[model samples]
Target chain A: MAGTNGTIISVNKVRKSYYRDTIEIPVLNNISINVPEGEFLALMGPSGSGKTTLLNLIAGIDRPDEGEVVVGGVNIAALSESELSKWRARHVGFVFQFYNLLPVLTAYENVELPLLLTNLSKKEKHEHVEFALKLVGLSDRMYNKPGQLSGGQEQRVAIARAVVTDPTILVADEPTGDLDKVSAAEIMELLDRLNKEYKKTIVMVTHDPRAAEKAHTVRHLEKGELT
Target chain B: MKIPLKYTFRNLQSRRLTTALTILGITLVVFVFAAVLMMAHGVEKTLVATGSEENILISRKASNGEISSIIDGETVNIILAMNQVARTPAGAPFATKDVATVINLPKTDYVGITNVTVRGVSPDAFALRPMVKIVEGRAFQWGAREIIIGNSIARRILNARVGGTIKIGGDQWTIVGRFDAEGCGFDSEIWGDVLQLTDALGRSNAFSTLTLKLRSPQEFDSFKEAFESDARLQQFVPKTERQFFEEQSETMALFIRVLGIFITVIFSAGAVIGAMITMYGAVANRTVEIGTLRALGFRRRSVLSAYLIESLMIALIGGIVGVVLASFLQFFSISTINFDSFAEIEFSFALSTGIIISSLMFAVVMGFVGGFLPAFRAARLNIVSALRAS
Candidate 1:
């Protein structure tokens, strides 16, 4: 539930597991966390430490096996698949490790994707796409396809797509994991500016210490438990 | 909301080789399907065009074709005296006693021999069939060893041209004229003097068939009833010319249709399987893209419909191209031996609106059947695993 004190996400005793050939492998064991409004939180751990699993749960793309995930006062774990999809479209912006922009679409068209789910007019969608691309410093590269852009530029376009709908929370899974040092620093700076100036709440999973340093709060997980 | 159609089209364009190959398979199948239907329609049209509504043909009872029927001179006289028979404006009956038979003829261009219909008819034969027009030279002289070959026979048979001579039954017959019968079955026959042909062929004063024009088309029922009731005429049967020819085409047309359906079914199965393979490859290649669209708020049904639309586009394109190719076949003619008459008849392929609609509908059905399972597999993919695909 939404705590009266401005907590936007509350995960209470969530447990998740995966199954392979009739055997259950635990990924998260009775985890609990809270992210306040406008808080930039980072989850850091070794590979297979359930960091991305927790982020996915908070984003409402996956459900916890045992407990409730309440975001913006709604128990997302109890929502149906269709309702959760709509909620994610309206409230959560997602950026992936590989910058999963549709390669067939131009940068401008990719940025305009999230708005296609909304009731916005074409003019409004154009305005939103232009503003999002400009905010990510890719206004000049809007007509380029993903294959034509560098890795960092493609990620910037992905970020533009994610924030075009003005989601309440942005969840990023290793946003700079596939980038060079220069591109990584630029992405971290963009995330910092979004959190500090725009007051956008962000949950990030990163193995890099430099990327975690930009967050206001950093949590570490070890062997499926918060350490 | 459904995914945009442009996205589906762009994906097809990206896989150009697979799309083109699958479309080609569908095109070949549709072409064969349409060609079969056009062939059957052509046979029916050609045979039906040979008969007139106001004419009645008299053949011996239990005979399948005119070649096997025999009518004596006395019975021919009885039929000519009937009041139902039409007059030829000079107080003469519009009746012809014709003898029909087949002779082997060598092909002009090829070394093989084929059966050609030879008809022996009186002078009144031309009056009964107005569609037959003499295009070269004059009609054969009565009681002379002369013949007028149809234009089709003149073109294909050796030494059957106008002013040429063909040896038949130990006698030389001069070819006097060539006629066109408006693309009907009569265009494949040779006509000559009935008495001379019967005497030369040793038929012993008997004609093979009697054709007479009725006063009106509606007078056929009474004429048939009266002819059947007469004890002398009981050995013969009367049938309206149109109905007789229509019945003659049924067996051959049915054979062609059944054979066509069989071949089409087999080819369509292969084509459908090919389409399924192509669609499966598409799904496998675009797993990540489908998951991306799902994550962006598109429903599973939208994914299904998008794939279906792509498959339909391929089939429709193939269908249109196949129909266009089949339409060109109407300009060419083919010859086949009629099962009942055992004589060659020439006809062309015919295309109709009904054939086009049916062929297109069959292609669509194949597309639907081939694409459904693959689209279902795409929709059933788990979002978690799909997004994780490389």
Candidate 2:
């Protein structure tokens, strides 16, 4: 169910914290933001500014300490751990800074990882995996393992894995942090195309200014507060 | 969703050295476990196969074995006259009064001497035991100063082969034949005429045991009752030959099994620890991979089962290799002293289905114990913290 205001995600007064051996460390203050459908949003912050923390809460990878994180009209903060995992599998796709591809699997297998949780038949999974890889412009490198691929190709494979399930939301954390300027530009262009052409809603965390230029909206965080 | 088996398998294959070493540890422990069981089973089988169920052995009431039992000629005659005794074709009673004693003999390979059983038998003893076949030479004549050696004794004892002379009880006896007792306890003995042996030992008109063939195996109860109830035969005890021989092996077999299992338990501990260390290393190295799997929506249960399956596969491989290694032990014979008779008996290790199942189960248990903690740790990892690991 879409929000009445055409929002796909609604975070209300979300707060999060980290603890180190009984020492409470506040990471995110009472920050709230709403993302409209098919919107590409970038979150920028200095180190320890809680920008990635906010992205994680919105992506359903972490629960907010004192707020409701409603994605696609479901209160994900109220879901049990196992229920949250199933929900994440059905709705969220992730692209991490390190590519996070299993080294033993080929690019094709890596892309098919998320679909293993689905009830899809082998043929259906193959079709989805092929389309995702082709969408990321890496269909030719699908048979190569991570060790055999370039850093850019590995991140492209990660993106293919992210979209193979046709998830409701795409979340990227430092997607260009490990790539060269040329490869980083290519990745940002792919994200921009996914948003504008494929109508995918994307939330990204990055320190790269040029990467933020591709998003529809940009938010900044200082300390634990949004500015 | 369940984790793919190929994922688990490839992880094992990725660390070849650790996997091989852990498997080797399990294999060694399983081999020892199987070999011990085989040894104990072999001793019981060899002794149990020595007796025929239809035959009854009469010994002194309080004696341990034929070596210590004594039955006079008059009592043997009285027992042979009973109707329960079987008859030969010539209508004579199928009974034999045999004398058994132990003599020190030099072993062919070992430096020290070992006790060898020497039995003095009646002429009809061969007719009673059909399993004793002459494999290499002719049977000894009844009245001659000749003897027959069992195949095991002929092979292991110095100068005990056919066409050789052995001095026993101050009398010279020529070895005339070699008989195979189908790997029974009899294969560890030497047989000769009872009269000549009794004369040589100066125990005239007395024998050590009276062995009789019953008219039918079912007549054992009545025969034992009749023999024990007779006033003249009251000092003698009768037991089915099978029961007596089986009892002969119980103590030694039990000892072997208990001692072997104790040692196996100690060795398996080391093997379990080796498996644990290897599994811990795997979990430590794959922390990020586990997080990726969890983030992809694989349940914690799936992760636990994947690690356990990996460990089980390693142990199963080890079990197979160990069983194959233990199977080869059947070709080599070992000799040990039968505590009841104080004579050395030779038998080969025997593998059975029960031992194989036991050994494999033991290995699986080790795998389960070793893999549990590491798998639990992997499953309990916090998704956010795990993903943050480099």
Candidate 3:
């Protein structure tokens, strides 16, 4: 399943629109982009450039008004809601800008949540959670809650959670947007390790020049058109 | 659906004030609901526990209880002569003429006048009623203006203690003693000589009713025919004492049940709304957490069940508290008007396992009904939008 030439994401001219009190506000206008498996890609854009909209479409979180989004070679819009959920659990891992870790759970439990979807034994799941935490360089802080961890530590926990299921693609939205320079450098370093060492296909959306510098290929998105 | 319990609990803890207020509302509703059920059951217990399953009560046709029936002293003797009647070792029939009356007695604890029953009976009355026993002072003297008050009379009503004298019709009747009848309805009365009570109340020719213990249940028809065949009487009813007491409870039981359901419905509605408000706030506060769960690949059904489980936990807490508080009331006494008898009746809060179980079931149902919509909202949240909430 680890391949450098296979396309993990394929979008066929997808379009998205929003409505503000019956006024159709177009967001992603006739866009198509794809990242192969194990390829690290960055989406760089200004505000209101439809970069997040395209990310949402690729992650199976939103449906396109026209055309189709196929992730991991499965057309998501064609799948039922429950099927899409199962696909998301198995095919995609997600990391967000703010490191949206549930504040109640310890970092270990946060990492263990996605693993619960797999049919792994409890002992095996524990092993995977431990490895994911260790991979993110926060194995010692596994017992700490998100609130107890610093911004960088919280993002690392989020990363651990995203990778626990060993998914084909990692969809990250400004993964270092809230971190300081040192923490941002640490996070980019962790994503770099995930891409190079684990052969992860990371698709990150960011306005940060440094974050984009870490990606193997950086593309500019302006007014829903990719360049 | 696998729901992590820690998420729900932490969300509840973060909104401590709302959760506490919601639980308090549920407690109040459950308390009122249980109290009404207890009172209703207490009414049924008041009647059902006092009557014997095998005894026969002879009265004029169509009459209800001893209060509305009248029989002569000569008829009392003749009915005592029937061979179908059970007897003691002294060769006397197991029957007695019970003269029952009610007089207004001022309540010691409240401002209203409560009617206390006064029963005049013969010495064999004690022998006929095996459940009757003197828990306190001795029996009343025969053919004298001396009365023994029932235990309820002594404790709740004024001027009922032994050795106390009270005037009736300008003559002071001495309270020579007090007694109990093993918690039967007789315990609510004052007992004295039939002749003296008839003479004092100036209804000298009438004894209110007679109770006869049959040799067996087979003699009931013959006994009824014998009374109805008497040419001089026409209006009294002859029934098994058990049936008569059961008839007396129907109206009171219906009244209590209706009242209980009414209060519970009104209060439970408000509690359900309160639970809705609390659950809505819980869902709102945990948007990011929910988003995290969704992004971690949890199904929508899991989030729905998690919120519902949290609401049920609150309701269960309130229900247990209400039941515990109601159990404490087993030691207190309550008196209310019995609709069948049209007289004041004393009762205790009757506790049964059914009442407690039903109360808990009711509260848990409220939690589900109230929490379902809000939990659905959480489940249907947009993952990207939810994660972006500041």
TM-score of each candidate structure, all chains considered together = 0.90, 0.94, 0.92
Window of ten residues with lowest summed lDDT in model 3 chain B: B230-239
Q: Please compute DockQ, using alpha carbons, for every candidate against the native two-chain complex.
A: 0.49, 0.73, 0.61
What is the two-chain DockQ of model 3? 0.61
Tens digits of per-residue lDDT for model 2, B211-285 = 889889899889878887899998998988888888888888999999999999999999999999999999889
Residue-level lDDT for A210 in candidate 1: 96
Note each model's CA RMSD in angstroms: 3.0, 2.3, 2.8
Q: Which CAPRI quality tier does the interface of model 2 achieve?
A: medium
Winner on lDDT between 2 and 3 is 2
Candidate 3 lDDT over A1-227, as tens digits, reads 43225888888898889888999989888888877888899999899899998888888877899989887767888987778778888888899988888887899988998887889999999999999999988989989988899999999999999999989899999999999999999999999999999999999999899999989999888888887
Query: Lowest lDDT 10-mer window, candidate 2 chain A?
Result: A55-64
Which portions of model 1 miss their true places by more than 4 Å?
A1-5, A193-199, B53-61, B69-84, B167-170, B204-212, B218-240
Better of 1 and 3 by TM-score: 3
Looking at model 1, residue A39 earns an lDDT score of 94
True-vs-predicted CA distance for residue B185, candidate 2, Å: 1.8
| Residue A102 in candidate 3, Cα distance off native in Å | 1.4
Pick the winner on TM-score between candidates 2 and 3. Answer: 2
Model 3: per-residue Cα lDDT over B1-390, one tens digit each: 376787777777777888888988888888877887887777677677666767777676656556777888777777777667888778878776778877777777877788777888866677667777777677777988988887888877876788987666456889888787766666777788887888898888688888778888898888778867865444556678777777767788788878778878888999999999888888898898788777667889998899899999888888888888888777777887677666677877778899899888988998988899988999999987887775
